[model samples]
Target: MNTDSTRRWLALGALAVAMLTIGLDVTVLTVALPTLAVDLHANTAALQWFSSAYTLALAAMMLPAGALGDRYGRKKFLLAALLLFGVASLACAFATSAGQLVAARVVLGIAAAAMMPLSMAVLPSLFPEPAARQRALTIWITSTAIGLPLGPIVGGWLLRNFWWGSVFLINVPMVIIGALAVLALVPESRSAQRFRVDVAGVVLSALGMLGLTYGFIRFGEYGWGNGLAWVAVAAGVLLLGAFVLWQRRTAHPLVDLGLFQSTGFRWGTALSIVVNFAMFGMFFTVPQYFQAVLGVDALGSGLRLLPLIGGLIIGSRVVDKALPKLGTRAMLAIGFALLAGALALGALTTVDSGYGYTALWTTVLGAGMGLAMPTAMGLAMGELTAERSGSGSALIQALRQAGGTIGVAVLGTVLATQYRSELGTLNRDPISDGVNAGVSVAHQLGDSAMLHQVQTAFVGGMAAMLWVCAALCAAAAVLAAVLIRAPRAAVGEQQERLDDAPHVGQGADASESTHVS
Candidate 1:
């Protein structure tokens, strides 16, 4: 490879490592919660905040961070965000109290918000070729996917051998390496035109996302009966509605509302959200199944997820080769088909089912994610111009974040309701909490019958949730077949037409630009 070619790949490697840190932080805390409760003298509410603070901050800042990166420089913001992430990780490690850790986590989330969108926004500038860009994106996405399962493994090891704070400290070296690599390898890029910041749009979008994310999180924790969660969800909807109306009227909108005009961008983003909804829901439940039902520890549970990672790698590598021939529409249909089939198989799990069965279905599930996610992401991002990429990428990520959060809430409700129903008269007091708690109660009482009942109830609940996920995937497969357009050329002629089109916002030419495809 030439020097420029080598540098671009190296830069992508650095960005991927940075992305891995963000993904790791998303789940690593789950493993550390018990340790944190003991070390920090934290209550249940405090433990929930430890995770929610990061999630809420991430949702709130995503849109504004992307807009800022576009206005300033993506490289500058990304580099700064990396350094800040390292600093916040340090803060989290040293924090003596739950409140302090929560504060540090919020900062970590803000830095991550900048990194997620800005890292993606620069990909077009790095690899201008459509084929090369898809390859790079697959690698980038796979890094994040790997880190999600790795989180529990890493965290479990740290907690076992070291201290709880070591989980946070682990991010430091990766951040340092990523920051230096990004600084040395990546070039700066931003919008050529200077536009005023849309203060109204930023405020509205930030608050709306925060409210929406927090509401779903609350709902997951407290169930549909939580009045506060409903209020927050209602308020979020109203604010987002207002933000959309304001975007149409504002001279400089935070997001280019016109991006939705492209069929590829709209369908790609929507399908991507559907994939995340199923993916996040599975992650939320499966670990619990391993721990509560199968009698595995955190580390063992994490190890079992290896099949998923392996399957994802296989599927991504295949798509990187096959996507050109099959096209996004067909690949998406195939992916959702695999997902539906795998989830349907998973729904057949009973208390007597073995790990081999779980492994078979999870592998297929991961393969489906690999095929669908990058194809859908590439389709949406393929429509973006360099000028609007930051905001456009952010818009896609924002909706995805919302979808994943809602999935956890909705699926958690399904599981919890079914679990309670199966428990019947037995679902009282301590047993009502969750599978883990119910299992603990059964063991403590040394009641074999109660143990059998708890295990059966949890398996039934899990099966019900899997069925719901299977139905969603089946629906998405049909939609992908109907809605997504197949590519007409090998080199992505549609993308070329878009790139050569006039930039949006040039008066009379704006409307013309919106209709490029």
Candidate 2:
């Protein structure tokens, strides 16, 4: 390879490593949550906050982070984000209490908010060829794919051998390596246009996401009876509505609302949310089940999750090979259908179900996710130009983060409710809190009957959550089938138009319109 070619691949390597650290951090906490609860004396709300806090910060700042990257420099912002992520990870490692850990997670999320979008935004400029870009995206996405599975395994080993904080500490080395690689290899790029920042839009969008996400989390803790949840939900809705109105009216909006006009961008964005909702929800529940219901150790739980990781890799390869002939709609619909079917099958689990049974369905679920997520993302981001890429990528990722946040909150509530109701005669402090607490309590008391009851109740809750996931996946499949257009030669045509369009100062005066592609 030539020097330029080598640099591009090296930059990709750095970007992939950066992306992997973020993805790993998200799921690594799952295997460690039980240990955290015991070590930190945390309640269910605190445990939820551990995950929700990170995702919330990520969702809230994504748009603004994108805009900043566009204005300043993508590489500069990414490097800073990586450094912040490293520092935050160290803080998380040393956190002595639940509150401290949650605070650290917020910082980590802000850093990730910048890193994820900026990393993706750089790809189009590095590889202008469609085929090369697709290959790069696959590598980029696969980093996330690898991290999800590796999280439990790596975290499990650390939890078994070292302190519970070891998971966060592990990120330190990866960040150092990534930072060095990025500094040496990646070229700085930014938007050609210097548009005014939409301050109102940023504030409104951040608060709106915060309220909506917090409302759902509060619902899990206090149920529908809480007036605070309702009010927060209402306020969030109003703010989001106003934000949209402001974006339409503003001269230089934070996000280009017109991107929604593209059928690919619209449905593709929706489908991305749907898949993550199902995926993150499942990740939140299963680790708990392995430890609480099946009596597996952290390491064992991680090992059992291997089938899921394997399936995701295999499924993505399948889709990549088939995309040329089957096109976007057919492949995405098929992938979603597989996901729905797998999760629907998973809902049939009983207390007696073993790893063999769980693994079968989880593998299929992973495959379906691998197939759908990257394809949907491609469709959403395919239409964006170099100048608009940062904000556009951020919007797509912002919705994804929102979906994951809501999914965890909503599904976690379902699991908790069903578990509490099924607690039967074992209504007590720890038992009412969560399955993990109940299992710990039962073991301490040497109460085999209570243990059995806790296991059975948790299974019942998991079944209910899986059923809900199945329904959502089914709906997404139908939407993709009906809405996503076939893959087209539109990118080349659009690029030509952009080239021919008028330019005034930094901004292009082209229509920036998109046809179905």
Candidate 3:
């Protein structure tokens, strides 16, 4: 490879490292939740906040982060985000209470919001060739996936041998390395024209997302009888509706509503939500099942998740080869089919089901997500121009984050409700509240019958949640079948247009160097 080519690929490596740290932060807490409950005296609500806080902040800030990067420079903003993430992780590692940890997670989320979208948006600028960009994107997506499995393994080991806080500390070194590499290698890029940041849109989007996410999370804790939950949901829906109207009317909107005109972008975004909803929802339950029900240690639970990770990695590798032949619609249909099938299989799991049963279904779930997510994301991003890449990428990612947040909230509510209902006359005041609490209570009481009841109820709840996911996946499959389009066949023509397109900040050399494929 030429020197210029080598530098670009190296730049991609830096971006991937940064992406991995954020991704690892997402699921790392799943395995650590039990440990947190024991050490920090975290209740069910606190546990939910640990994950939801980060995702909610991420979803809320993504639009602003992307716009900032577009208005300023992607590299500089990314560097600052990395620094903030490192510091926040340090704070999280040393948190004394559940509230402190949740607060730190919010800071980490804000920092990550800046990093995630900007790193992705910078890709088209770095690897202007379509083929190179595809390869880079695959690596980028794979780096994020690598963290999902690694989070369990690493967090498991840390929780087993060290303190629960080690999980957050692990991110520090990764952040430092990512920052240095990015500073040395990645090129700066941004829109030449300064677009006014829509402060009203940002406020509306953030409040709407926070309201909806907090409402569902609260519903899981307090049930639907709580009027506050419904009020928040209703207010969120109204605010989001207002946000859409405002964006449509604004002269310089935070998001380019016109991007939805592309059929690929529309369905791709919808499918992305479906994939994350199922994926995140499943991740929420698996650790609890392994630790609380099966009596496994953290490390053992992490190892049990290996098959799912393996399937994800293998599926990501296979999609590129399959996409050309299968076309977008066919690949998406097959992917969602696997997803629905996997979730249906998961729903059949019993309290006494072995690890092999869980592994089989989770592996299938992973494969389905691995295939669907990247393909849909590629389609959504494929037609976006370089100038609008930051806002565009942020929109895609923001919705995906929102989907994950809502997934956790909705599925958690389902699980909690079903578990309580299945308990049937059992005293569940504080001891038998959630799966973890019920398990702890049964162990303390030394009642094998009570233990059995708790496990059975928890399993029933899990099964109910999986069934809901399966139904959603089935719907996503139908949508993908009807809406997703094939890859655009005219690569050469697209490249020619890109070359001729006016670039304000960059020179002719920058445009000339960029190849469409």
lDDT, residue 497, candidate 1: 52
**lDDT of candidates 1 onward, in order:** 0.89, 0.83, 0.81
Number of clashing pairs per prediction, in order: 0, 0, 1
Best model number under TM-score? 1
If ranked by lDDT, best first, what sequence of candidates would result?
Answer: 1, 2, 3
Compose the digit string of candidate 1's lDDT tens values, residues 244-272.
Answer: 99999987889988888888888889988
- What 10-residue stretch in candidate 3 is worst by lDDT? 508-517
Colliding residue pairs in candidate 2: none
Q: What is the lDDT of residue 425 in candidate 3?
A: 70
Where model 2 places Cα greater than 4 Å from the true spot, the runs are 33-49, 95-100, 420-430, 441-450, 488-507, 510-517
Best by lDDT: 1
Q: For candidate 2, give the lDDT of residue 414.
A: 84
The parts of candidate 3 lying over 4 Å away from their true place are 30-52, 95-102, 430-432, 487-517
RMSD of each: 2.0, 3.0, 3.7
Per-residue lDDT for 62-169 in model 2, tens only? 989988887788889989999999999999999999999999999999999999998898887787665567667777887887788788889988987899889999
Q: Over the stretch 265-324, how does candidate 3's per-residue lDDT look in tens digits?
A: 677788888888788778878888999888997778778888888888877878867766
Model 3 local distance difference test score: 0.81
TM-score of 3: 0.90
Query: Which residue pairs clash within candidate 3?
Result: 130-516
